[model samples]
Target: MEGHTGCTTKIVTLCTFKLSDAHVHYRTPLTSYFISHTSHLTSHWQSITLQNLYLIPHTSYPIPHTPYPIPHTSYFILHTSYFINNIYYL
Candidate 1:
């Protein structure tokens, strides 16, 4: 994975293989910025979200309800779950 920063923005990049099977997961403790991507031999999976103090964007994936205290800024946690065949992996 690669992370980049601009004047007031951040970017992240990741690479994967086509034949590979993978699942990605993410969670945040506070409002923050996060983006994720998965690469296949033919295409890539991309997602981006910005968490604000007042509101957060809707995501296709469901987020768990946790009772962690949130600060004024943004926080992000990213996790990827990978599985192959009948085997479980991360």
Candidate 2:
């Protein structure tokens, strides 16, 4: 987490299958989350999960400083991504 302290963009990839598998398995696409340099990734995602759970569609609720509203379809994706990211970090 050394170089990550600055304002830099990072790409976090979440895979559906293990890397040991060579077979061409279908990958589940995930929605990308752009976290700010000022925030911790895991903690921010956890907060996002909460906001998404309670947010209604078409509401003006933004994910913290982000302008995007929580979409109905993103509920499952956010939870899955958060869990995956948490596991990866651990």
Candidate 3:
């Protein structure tokens, strides 16, 4: 999925792999900005809070955004759990 407000933007992606024991989850923001930080994926459900929800105007698959574009931004989403896997890209 994709969302855009104007020109500031970052690519957000999430992938989940079902394993025999648990899920192997992959996220773009986590791996892109924090390569040194890693966390184990689990089947357990998680909760998160999303703030400043906006109705983007752009109709791109990978949403583009703000007054100007900002590449490789990690602080795009207020909360990661706000979007499901493969549904939002900003």
In model 2, where do residues sit more than 4 Å from their true spots? 1-62, 76-90
Question: Could you tell me every candidate's TM-score relative to the true structure?
Answer: 0.18, 0.16, 0.17
lDDT of 2 by residue, 11-90 (tens): 22222222122221123336433322212232333212221111122233234443444443222212223332232110
How accurate locally is residue 87 in candidate 3, as Cα lDDT from 0 to 100? 24
The pairs that clash in candidate 2 are none
TM-score of 2: 0.16
- Compared with the true structure, what per-residue lDDT tens digits does model 1 show for residues 2-65? 2222212221232222212323234454533232232221244334221211112334234454
Residue runs of model 3 more than 4 Å from their true location after superposition: 1-46, 59-90
Candidate 1 contains a number of clashing pairs equal to 2
Which ten residues in a row are the worst by lDDT in model 3? 33-42
TM-score of 3: 0.17
| Worst 10-residue lDDT window, candidate 1 | 81-90
Stretches of candidate 1 exceeding 4 Å from the true structure: 1-64, 72-74, 82-90
lDDT, model 3: 0.27
| Superior by TM-score: candidate 1 or candidate 3 | 1
